[model samples]
Target: MIEIQGNIKTVGLTCGYRNMPIVSDLDIVLPHGKVSCILGKSGCGKSTLLRTLLLLERPLAGDIRFGNLSLNKLTAEQLKQLRRQTGVLFQGSALFNSMTLLENAAFPLIERAGLPRGLASELALLKLDVVGLSRYAHYLPSAVSGGMRKRCGIARALALDPPYLFLDEPSAGLDPLTSAEIDDLVLEICDALATTVVVVTHELRSIERIADHLVMLADGGVAAAGPPDQVRRSDIPAVNAFFSPQSNAAPLIDPHHGLASLLLDEE
Candidate 1:
C-alpha cells in the first residue's frame, strides 16, 4: 500500500478562469488519509478549486503544497513525477469507447508506470474488483450502464495505486441507489488502501455517507470547514441554507399538474 503521510495545504489560494477570480484567498487543509469533501451550492468554484489542486489550472495566487513539495515550484518533470502519485476521476467518467473495461483500466499503469501489459492487466483487474466491476472486465463502455462506467473510470484511476485520489462529482447523473453504491465504494477504497480522497460534490447524501472532513464554499471563500456533524449545525447563512434547504422552502406543488391548477386550488 502507498504511504500518504502529509496533508495537502492551500494557502491564500485564488482560482478562476483568466483574471476574474471566482474564489479568492482560500486557506484549506485537506487532512492526510481522510476523505475531504468540498461542498457548496452550484457554480461556487468547488470544481475550479479541484482543478487547481490537480494542477490542471494555474492558481491566480498562493500555493498548493502537498507535504514538503510545493506545486507551484515544481518543474515540468517534477510536476509529472508528483502527478504519478495522484489519481483523478473526472465527472464524465471519460472512459474510451473503443477499449474494453480491462484495457481502459490498465492504460494508466502501462503508460505512466511503465508496467508490462500482463502485470498492468492484473493490477487493473484487481482494481476493477475493488469497485465491484470485475465481472464486466471485457465489456465495452457503450455496453455498460452509467454507474458501471463510473466504476470502470474509478478502476482506471486506481490502476497505478496512487495514494492521493480526487473525484469530481462522482455521484452526479446517477440514481440514488447507484450513487449510494458509489459512496460505499469510496469508503471501502479509503479503508482498504489508506488513500487520501478529495471529493468535490454538492450532494448532501454523499457528504453524509463519506466525508470525514468538510469544506463548504460560498462567495469564493470557505463559509464553513469542519467535521460533518459540526458543519450541519453551522450558523453561516450560506452554509446553513445549503445544509437545510427545506427549512425555508415554499409550499409544495405538483409539477405534473399545471401552475394554473395549483393557483386555482390555493384560491
Candidate 2:
C-alpha cells in the first residue's frame, strides 16, 4: 500500500565517514507490496544505496519520500515515526550474545512499541513461533547454529510488525540450502503479511527464487531494473553479465558440510 511515485531520486548520494561519494545519480522506484532485490558486485555501492534509503547514511544531494512525506522535510520525531514502519536485518544476524532468544526478539517491541514487559514477551514468543524458533526461546544466541541465529534475527525484525522490511545480505554466510530456507521464509513473510521487502544480495540463486523486482547497480547508477525475467532478458551488458552464469566464479560448497568442493550443486 506504499505508493512511491515519481522517483526516489538521488542526484549525488554518497557514503563513508568523511561524506565522500560512493555512488551518484541513483534513481529508483521501489513499488508497493513487491520484493525488490538490489544486485551488484562487491563494493559496487549496493550497501551504500540501502543505507541511504534507510536513512542510516546521509544523502549528499537527494530527496527521499515515503508516500506523501518528504524524508528530508520530516522532523526528528517524524523521522522516528517513519522508521517505526520499517524493519531492518543487518548482514550478520546481529543478535546479542548476552540475551536469550526471546529477549532479543522482544527488544524492539519493549523499546519502540512501549508495550509492557509481559506483553512484549508474549508477542516475542508469538513471532518466534512464526519463524519456527519457539523452542529456542530460552537458548542464548551463542548456543544456536548460524542458521538458527539468522532466524532469530528475522523474528526480531518481524516483532514490530513493520510494513517495510529491509534485509542486507540475508544469505551471505550460510550454505545454499540454508540460504534457500531463508528465501522461503522471506517469501512466506511477504505472502502472509503483504510486507514490502528490499533485499541487498549478490546471490543469483536468491535473486531467482525471491525477487519480484530487480535493480542492478553499477558505475554509480542503476544499470537496469524490472521484474527478474525482464531484467534477465535485458540487452544491457551489465544486466546480462549479472544474470549470466559465466560471471559466477565463487567456489561451490556443500550445503550440509559448509565446505568448498568441486561439485556443482543446484538448490
Candidate 3:
C-alpha cells in the first residue's frame, strides 16, 4: 500500500448537494488502517458525507483534514494530487464494459501512476489475486456475475495501491453468499494491505462482520460513533430501532437487502 498514516478528521462538517444540508455539524474521526462503515437510513446523508470526504462533492460547510492538509486550503494541483492518492469503488463498480478485467484493473496504474501497460497489467493481476479474481482476469465484466464484477472493481481500486479506499454500497445487490464473499475480500484488504477503508453501506451482517469502527447518522448528525458492538448496544431510540431488528428472525429474503422486503432496509 501507499504507506499513509493518520486519522481523517472532519471538523464541523455540513455536506449536501445544491446547498441544502443533509449532514450538519458532523465531527467524526476515521482512524488509520481500519475499516470504518458509515451507516444510516435512506436520505440520511451517508453517501453525501463520504462524497464530501473524498472531495468528489464539495461540502457546503466544514473543514476536512487528512494528516496536515486541510481540504479547503489545498490548491488545484494539491487537490489533483490528493485525488490520485486515494481509490474509490463507486456504487456501480464503474468498470469499462469493453475492457478485459485485466485491462480494467490496470487502467489507474497506467493512467494515474504512469506505468507501462505491461507492468500495469502485471501489478493489476496481483490486485485481482488479492480479491480472488486472478482466474477471471481475462474475462470481460459483462461475462462475469455481479459479485465477480464487484470483486473486479476492488481489484481496480487497489491497482494504484492507494492508502485510502472508499466504497459506496459495496454489496448493494447480490445473493447473501455473494455479499458475504465480498465482505471477506474487504476484511482481507484491510488486514493485508493495512489500508484505511471507508464504506457506505446498510448491510447489518456485513457491518458486524467487517467494521472495526462504526459511525451511525440520524437527524442530520451523528447518532452514534464507535466500535460496532458498542454502537449496536447504544440506547438511542433510532439506534435501537435500527439494530434491534437484527435479533429478530431473518425473513425469507436475506435481511440485509430488505428495503423491498421489509423495514430498516432502506438506504
C-alpha lDDT values of all predictions = 0.89, 0.83, 0.87
User: Could you give candidate 1's per-residue lDDT for residues 66-89 as a string of tens digits?
Assistant: 877887787777677778888889
Q: Candidate 2 on 74-106: residue-level lDDT in tens?
A: 787778776887888888888988999999999
Residue 90, candidate 3: C-alpha displacement in angstroms: 1.0
Candidates 2 and 3 compared by TM-score, better number: 3
For candidate 2, report its TM-score: 0.86
Model 1 global lDDT (CA atoms, 0 to 1):
0.89
Q: Could you tell me how far off, in angstroms, the CA of residue 234 lies in candidate 1 after the best superposition? A: 1.7
Residue 29, model 1: Cα distance from true site in angstroms: 0.4
lDDT per residue as tens, model 3, 1-267: 223357889999999989799889999999999999999887799988988998888888889987767888987877767777788888889899999999999999999889999999999999888888899999999999888888899888888777789999999987889899988888888888888899999988899899999999988999999998899888887787678766542243565564745565347
Q: In model 2, which range of ten residues has the least summed lDDT?
A: 1-10
Estimate TM-scores for all models: 0.90, 0.86, 0.88
lDDT accuracy of residue 39 in candidate 1: 90
